[model samples]
Target: MKTLALLSAAALTTTLLATPAHAAVTQWGACLPGQGVDPRQECTTIEVPMDYSAPGGPSVTLAVSRIKTARPEVRRGVLLIIPGGPGSPGLNRPSTLVKKLPQEVLDRYDIIGFDPRGVGKSSPVSCGLAPADLSLTRLKPYPDADGGIAENAAWSRRIAEACARNGGPLIRHISTRNHARDIDRIRAALGEEKISYWGVSYGTYAGAVHATMFPATTDRVVLDSNDDPDPRKVSRQWLANYAVGVEDSFPDFGVWAAARDSDYGLGADAAAVRKTFLDLAARLDREPLAWPGAKPEQLLTGNLLRETLLNALYSTANYPMLAGLMKAALNRAELPMPNQPEEAALQNTAAHAGATMCNDIEWPNSIARHEQQVKRNRAVYPLTAGMPVNLGPCAYWPFKPAEQATRISSRGPANVLLIQNLRDPSTPYSGALKMREAFGQRARMVAVDSGGHGVYLANGNACGDRTVTDFLVTGHLPARDRNC
Candidate 1:
């Protein structure tokens, strides 16, 4: 549901030649403030072609950052942190990683981070969409009252048109395939013979693409909360997977909420808690509530409430955010929603996400077909409703994908490691199995008996954390998949 930070430093790239070598130069310097900055972090930039097809054409700058290990004597190699999100910013991840990662792991390599092209300080692009269209509920594309998709269809067309008019040429080239290419460019600029990698959520897909494209150059690869790398579907499949993911994860929230029914009164037990959520969502659908700063057009509608639950499902620490809101809503009280990003940031995120997903693979162009999927998904997955299929971009996207989506192959090194929560609300376990299958014998999975989005160094599962930490530091994986 959220993208993790990877790097936050001043990464600026020099112009380069068109060959695959991408003969580029890197000059490291102090990072600008506020991209997960740490005093120890150094920032630089690398230039990668906007469109890999035309390497001689213009390039986009990628902000790269690193925290070199204090124990240079024991330094193993470069460990690149790939940020999550088709639209997530990088450059500040080294700062965040320094705090979360074990010192032993941090001491082994020059941990690197970078903003993908068309994101953050790296030649950002936007669709200039209206603030209303940028809201979480609208961006997720929930259907109108009575489950009709008329508004969703029209909004999709409208946003697609906005992106076409304002996104310029750079937006057209943003995709996982290009992200992998940019990573290789970073590798070349770093002068590394091989690089180890860590990518979470969407970063997992990006890292997979890198491993598939440049296998031999990759040393150790770790993918946490992975996406189903089904080449034919790619991001389109990810969009629809919400139905299954939410269904898998919501039960954990339900049990947790039910245990504290005395505090929030969400439900007396797990079954009751589930009922309360469904019923409350239905009631809100009929009549939305008001909130400060939501504007007249944006209120706490049923879909918005559903969005809140989806976000809260990511981590138990954030569960109180949802519980408080649900309590307030039921009591007719006011509560603030989390993460009200500025309109400009929202526009950029929407544009990048739309371009990356739409360009990754073709989506059904027929609005009627989308509506049909919405109807089917809504009935089966009441928690997420039909928002999973109620897309507002790909169906009306203005351009065909510049290149085919990357197929994550099993021919890569078996150094790949996957860590997942069985009940992830974003990248569900069923889908993770698909990614595991795609890699075949090339990967080992650590299925943690936890309930959260991120697993390694997150969620506080000692078994899961120790396994991944051992793998990263020692380069040894379990003989087979393990359960923690």
Candidate 2:
């Protein structure tokens, strides 16, 4: 999930709970069979109107699952795990991550997961993109040397058209606002007065919107790897932040590369390692190496490295891959292409991500503006090579935003906790700071001195994890900012 939207401190408690008239009326039953993890983890289908305004209009099914508390005596209520990827499904999370939680936490709450509309196990939407069209480099935003994006623009138009034709009506309604509404509907179905939430990446944005639209319903929230909720920019801002993120995390990779010089032999010093990478990328840009069995055998330097770097930034465990690639490229030796995600899986994921980004807010359609911005970004931040600020398929997407972006206010209860990495290559610290500022006194931020995406149980330091866990367990937070 991407970062969440903003919330205001309005006394929205009155709107938090379902009305008594609606409480007993559970339109969607307990979870259905063969959906997620344990059979005990119930799954159910909820039919929601395709268009919210026309409650009785064409409807689609939302797939949901829940694992009730293992210990009824300590059970508090439901804790929703919001998945990132505007289109990522939460359906199997309860079986996966929920089981990882400490026994005490599990004992206190029923864990819930769901596939948002147009996602897995729900009503899915696709752009029907060809396998070639799903390549990481191709899907990534890249600009031509002359700062021209004619190719990108054309590709975007093609992708948009495909989605328009194949996505059906569900594609148009994939914005964050609607997703929040869907969460609320799930809350109502669960028959809970309020819900605690753990939102990661894009999930944070969904949680924020839910809090803003129905603040009182948010019992406790943990927003990890936060993104700035700037309505005007949205994902554009996120992409731009990648440049800063790379600058921050590259040093960690540099250290690792330097340390392994004897084995991989990329460089003897950190500075040399950096130079070697940049040089290799520059050379690759001019003449790509042919990688056997790869989608595009001719590996363009920028894309190959960018994709590799993106994957590496997921966690320190991946640093070896980057190191090996760097070593192979340095010696002009053959390097294997990264394994591609399954075509159907990639399409589904990309379509979901695209729908969420496209529907979250409107993107500027001016090619001239995007071209100029890309040129400036390339000149200023060569590491990212202007991909961050370049135009996306959303620029040519067929749908308009369903609603204005929600503004986050700090007016809700002080129950929000944010955990962020200082040098995250995906979500940068600067952006997390923006989220912290937006939440103001209502949230406490624990900034970890780590170099990767994700926090909490993932890339988080012990101090950071403890902070979040303490809050989830005891509802206690530091009075102010704390650096880990």
Candidate 3:
């Protein structure tokens, strides 16, 4: 449900580029102040047009960071690490990856990260949404028992209106295509002839588009936990796939919960554990539980349980948390404390998700179609309650997309390596295959026998990590797609 941060920083010293707004230069300075700031990391800024079509128009500043190797004698080139969520900023990515990445990888290239335009330190966009409306349950619609989305439609209109009112011209330009263009600008600012890239989740799509549009400029490309690059669907398909992904991932949690000698003591078998979960969810739906220090309904209902489960499946480490939550709820026990993000941060994240998704392409405005899809999805995948197929702010988005979604092609240089988990709860193996097929022979995939969203250096098997790191260091892709 949340994209992890991989951003690290470099300090800044601004210098004007000889080129116009589209090709501004980067100026390096010291890391101002933040967590996990390494002395090795430098912070800088790159200016790109708010709209690429109008290169001479007003520009927006993108906050960029990099961690360069100590041994420049061995430095190969720049490695741009793209962040997911379109909303997620990458300024902190390098700090986290630096500790886990092989020294050889660190020695070979400077790892660069940035807050995508309209995110984080970059020129941001906000809807000024109410705190109640910013809740996750509210941001993602959960239909009523009648399977009607009347309320969701209302919320969508309100959200869209708010965003249109508050998010300036910049919001309209936060598409994947613009994001790809931003990456190229970063490359030019770094003065790199060609750059390597590692992109995860949404980052994978942006990287793929970059590779497609500017193949000659790409050196090494690694796409992890990929999304389906179906040009016609884009984020809509990614959202819908959540239903399938949750179904595939839930069993892993069930198996863990039912393991022999499990300390949680929810059930003796996987079936029994699932039953316990379903029973509790039904009970909550009938009688929502009061939750202190929570907002929007401030009640624990079945939908929240479903949403929590979906979020928990992002990492195996969250299995215990979900299990404990269930156990507490089933005992009529007090729920464990929930972690809440600040209201402003939530607003920013929602704005980014909306702006980027809506700006990428048009979503169907037909409530009837959305209702049919939700009802069908609920029947087929009850675990997710059709939330994945429900209407979002994009349904009522005000502006037409500035550009059509990019169609990923095998027309790129043969330099891409994709690593995916067999049962990723967010970007499942099924969707990953689509991205792999989209790239064709231009890419090779390493399917890890794992279950989680992120792949390399986070949730993937060591073999997958080794394959990616090796590709980064030596530019050697697997002879064929390999499973780990």
Model 2 over residues 45-106: C-alpha lDDT tens digits?
66666677766566666677778887898788888998876556678788887656877788
Per-residue CA lDDT of candidate 3, range 1-484, in tens? 3411111222222322223654545468886677777777888887888878878777888888889887799999988889887677788778878988899999988989888887777877788887777766776788865577998999999999999998777778888898898899889888888989999999999999999989999999999999999999999999888888988887788889989326777788877877777778778888888877666558888888877887788888878778887878877788887766666566777888889899898999899999999999988988878888999889999999988899899986789999999888778889999999999989999999988889998888788889998999899899999999
User: Candidate 1, which segments miss by more than 4 Å at Cα?
Assistant: 1-26, 295-297
In model 1, how large is the Cα lDDT of residue 60? 78
Candidate 3 accuracy as lDDT: 0.83
The residue-level lDDT of candidate 2 at 166 comes to 83
TM-score of each: 0.95, 0.90, 0.95
Query: How many clashes does each candidate structure show, in the order listed?
Result: 17, 21, 22
Q: How many residue pairs in model 1 have overlapping backbones?
A: 17
- Model 1 alpha-carbon miss at residue 271, Å: 1.1
The worst-scoring run of ten residues by lDDT in candidate 3 lies at 3-12
* Top candidate when judged by lDDT against the true structure: 3
lDDT at position 219, candidate 1: 90
lDDT of 2: 0.76
